[model samples]
Target chain A: MIVFVSCIILFLIGLYAIVTKRNLIKIAIGFAFIEYAVNLLFALIGFKRGALAPIITQIDKPHNFVDPIPQALVLTAIVIALGTTALMLTVILRIYNRYKTFDIAEIRKLKG
Target chain B: MLFIPLLFALPLITAFVIPILGKIYKPLVWIVTTVVSFILFIIALYGVAVTQEIPMSVYKMGNWPPPLGIVMAFDSFSAFMVLMISIIVFTTSLFSLRYLSRFTGQWKFYTLFMLMTAGMMGISITGDLFNMFVFLEIAAISSYALVAFGIEGEELEASFKYMVMGEIGGLTFLLAIALIYAKTSTLNLADISNSMQVIRGTTFFWMIIGMMLFAFSIKAGLVPFHTWAPDAYPAAPAPISSL
Candidate 1:
């Protein structure tokens, strides 16, 4: 329970950084923070009190194992996070090239 | 049930094979991606028809039963989403063939786009909540990076903003999943529902409600969270923005 709340808190911290901050790289990092927090939460979800790995054992009885679903999901989430982080970085690099700044406040060239 | 896995496999294989052929033939990626997505759309339509009911078929992974292995099920709602996702992928690929020339890495767009498609398909197909979370992150993160591919200040800024919101949504979902797992001792969606039913009116319901709502709300980019769109979209080269 405490762990779960802390995840939420970390997420909020990222959110605050994203919303309130103006540095482009900072915002991107803030987004990464949020992504990591979410992935952590997903991994935490499949955990059990005393469950073991879901792999089939040689001698042990077919019981007492951790949920494999969350583990699988976490692997998938990590890959997804990698893809997104890479994309974000590329875009940030482009933005910097065009405007010559990583500060969000100065990049108001797209306001409507 | 079987069609669900095909969704991932077909696109994944196509995504991989197309890149190789793209270097030699040029039109290969477009042709292969289109054909695969068309097939997927046709299958998704059939799936939608078969799964017309509220509770549709569930395909357990690797022949293992629920609560042990992953399950892929489709109700009418999910089938509808699948249909739309297929269309989105198809259209995006078609558009990208011409639209992505402004950027240097053409294969990267296709890779990310297909991965995003597969991720969305996984999310729609899986009946397990945690599985959905994984797929959701896959889709969300890819889109986030896609937004910033241009690497302009505006593109980067928008991607950053989108990432922030997406991260928050992810956390909310994780917290909710953890809370549920702790209480039910089961991670399967149907199983969790079954176990939680006994405690539906209690904090369990509230926890689920809070978690899913936050995540989905962020995903849909509903009213409150739509702020990231204008900046990122225009900042990205037109094709990605359109995508």
Candidate 2:
């Protein structure tokens, strides 16, 4: 409910940053912010009212366990985020090397 | 049954193996990749034939059933996607042999290209939601590197922008999947769909669907997200750009 709405709000804020910002790195970070917000929202989605972690150490019957599927899925998504972040940073570094600036406006040699 | 896994595994294994052989013999990069994709294309044709008979086939990994284990399901649609991918990869590899001569590190190109192919195949055939996300990342990460293969200023800029959009897309998709899983308590697409029958037409359900649609649109470079597509394509090598 409220948490989901807040998550959407956070995503909108990131989208706003992307739309309004001019720095290349800032825009990249804005993208990362959106991802972070979404990941948070995902984890929140799997939250239970009064549930324990969805793990089984012994053979006892579990009570009110949180869903494990989204947790596993989020772990995989985080790994993906890490890879994309590293790659984005690498590309940004190369862009800086060639253009000598991080400003999106200044790096517009591809302007049509 | 076996062919489904082979469709993903063969290309992935070759992606890793090609880079090593490439260090020793350069020409083998083109030969190996081209032949592998051609074989995959043939396999995809066989997949079509097999599916035509059975109509729908499911291959569960580790012999675990759909609700617990990952499965690869092939029907007309997935088989068609596989066939399309095989054709695209085979032609791209063959063309890259002549077209990529001007580019250094041709072996790296073939390696990443095959990796992307493997990822695409994995995405198309997998019946599990999370498995699709993982494969989508594999394809995306490889493409990000491929787009920046030239390492020019514009190329790097474009690749960075593309990576940003793609990561956001992936995360949004994960959010949607999480929402679905929270409601359905299942990760299998078929299982989720079955359970969804009991809990349809809710606001939560529609939000999940909307989020998924938005994510996929970004991935596919639809109108709102098409900003990265134009810049990234031109930045990549000509052969890869065509791909």
Q: Which candidate has the top score in TM-score?
A: 2
DockQ of 1: 0.47
TM-score of each: 0.80, 0.92
Instruction: Report fnat, model 2.
Output: 0.70
RMSD of each: 3.8, 2.1
Lowest lDDT 10-residue stretch of candidate 2 chain B: B174-183
lDDT of 2 at A12: 83
- True-vs-predicted CA distance for residue B70, candidate 1, Å: 0.6
**Collision count of model 2:** 0
Give a tens-digit lDDT track for model 1, residues B84-134: 988776776677777766667666667667777788888888888777877
Q: Per-model C-alpha lDDT, please?
A: 0.74, 0.86
Q: Count the backbone clashes (under 3 Å) in each candidate.
A: 12, 0
